[model samples]
Target: MTSPDVLDSYAPVVAEWYSANARDLPWRRAGTTPWGVLVSEVMLQQTPVVRVAPAWHEWLARWPTPAALAADQPGEAIRAWGRLGYPRRALRLHECAVAITERHGGVVPSVLDELLALPGVGTYTARAVAAFAYGQRHPVVDTNVRRVAARAVLGEPDAGPTTTAADLTLVESLLPLEPPLAALVSAALMELGAVVCVARTPRCGVCPLAERCRWLISGAPAPVGPTRRPQTYAGTDRQVRGKLLAVLRESHGPVAKDALDAVWGDQVQRERALAGLLEDGLVVTPAPGIYALP
Candidate 1:
């Protein structure tokens, strides 16, 4: 077997491993509609799978299609979002629903460019939808994919924070030619990264790539990048934003300014957080002294 053959050998083993080990994600079900996949992908963007699971089910139950979500008020969407932290994504997802209903005739677009043009769809997300929804062969490189490829293939302990154009090419070249196989392979690689090739403590023993890992051969050098920490929510803008949104989410319409002030004790910080949400279009001041979820 040649070098390409050697590289390609990993696919079958990975797919086999995936068959037995893959988590029973609803979106991965045989008859899962594209709308369900899109919803799962959007909700999974920055939130963890554990948090997204129930929300995903509840959301699909309420609005199984884009046209249905598009018909709902943004206020309801925010309330449904329920402390997801990044509330802006909720607004953008609502806009995406409206755009999909209007432009794509309520169908999730399969073309990468078409998906990219939709609001809130970024490079990773666009490719993910195209490949997963339509059986297209495109590299779906999220943080997990990047990290796994970096360590197992490129000999890098960690992928840098930013995804470069070259990173996409590197991952794309490894994808199988067959569309469905390629899609399965992409998900398998992501699963490997998330579960086995973890950031803090990689489980090399169970990893399919353990024997072939470049990082293992290179003696596992430290990451040549800035380290990060779990973000502190207390006294941060995120906490304040959560506080402000909670008030608006509970209210039917515009909440009195004084009512919002009751959520956070610090008057100045609460005001700033409300202003930030308004600037981000997550909230609107329907009246002079009242706030509401936008």
Candidate 2:
């Protein structure tokens, strides 16, 4: 039942709002390299913007191009990753740099399929790079964009569990005709969802779409049943893995199993966590019972 006119108005209105209100992220700045956009996307996956800002600056300074990163060891990527959480992303990014070097002559590929072929690049990332980095008109749907589309267009409190094909179709339907403007609209939608139409306690009074939002017109009903569960980190294998990785990252050379063993008290949980890291290719067994980053 979503009106076509209302959806059509989204790009222009949100684009204007974003021009005045978008955050001053480095990656959004003019002349930022495609590699910068790629790195920022990977870092921003599960981490917050406030934390990502400095790390992003440092990362680009150290390895400004894929060629620079591809020249270094993968372990150096992990070391420079610096408490970003999900250190595996660092390894994947390293592999992505290598792929770019070998496959695309060290430049971030502009074509969506070529970008998607890089290690750890997913649909969202591929489309984001194509649209944001290359000025190609592709829908860049993330959690934030999905939520914005759901509430503003569908009158829903939240989006589905994850971005689906329908999500891409919905956003693409709203995009402007011109490629550059379409990219702008995509960024604007993400910014709106991130800041104004946030998951909890959205500040609708400040929202650009407050007057036309479907969810707002529908009384903004609370989500039905129990809300989605939040992820826990304490006492989990993830925490154990993080602790072990921190030890390895701080060390210049391979860390003995005893050193890793001392990081977590529970032998079973620690072993499980270490095994997971090894299986993930984040950690390598340089020798029997000796661990180092790959």
Q: Report the number of the highest-lDDT candidate.
A: 2
State how far residue 205 of model 1 sits from its true place (Å): 0.5
Q: Which stretches of candidate 1 lie over 4 Å from their true place?
A: 1-3, 224-231
Clashes of each: 0, 0
**Which 10-residue window in model 2 sums to the lowest lDDT?**
224-233
Model 1 lDDT-worst window of ten: 1-10
- lDDT tens digits by residue: candidate 2, 1-294: 667887898889999999999998999999999999999999998799999999999999999999999999999999999998999889999999999999998889999999998888998899988988999999999999999999999999999988899999999999989999999999999999989999989999999998888899899999997865778889999899999999999999998889999998999999999999999988999789899988
Task: Output the number of the TM-score-best candidate.
Answer: 2
lDDT by candidate, in order shown: 0.85, 0.92
Error of 1 at 226 (Å): 5.2
Model 2's number of clashes is 0
Model 2: how far residue 63 lies from native, Å? 0.7
TM-scores, one per candidate: 0.94, 0.97
Compared with the true structure, the alpha-carbon lDDT of candidate 1 equals: 0.85
Shift of residue 255 alpha carbon in model 2, Å:
1.6
lDDT of 1 by residue, 180-289 (tens): 99998998888988888898999988988878888987898987656877888899878988888887877777878888888888878888888889899999887899
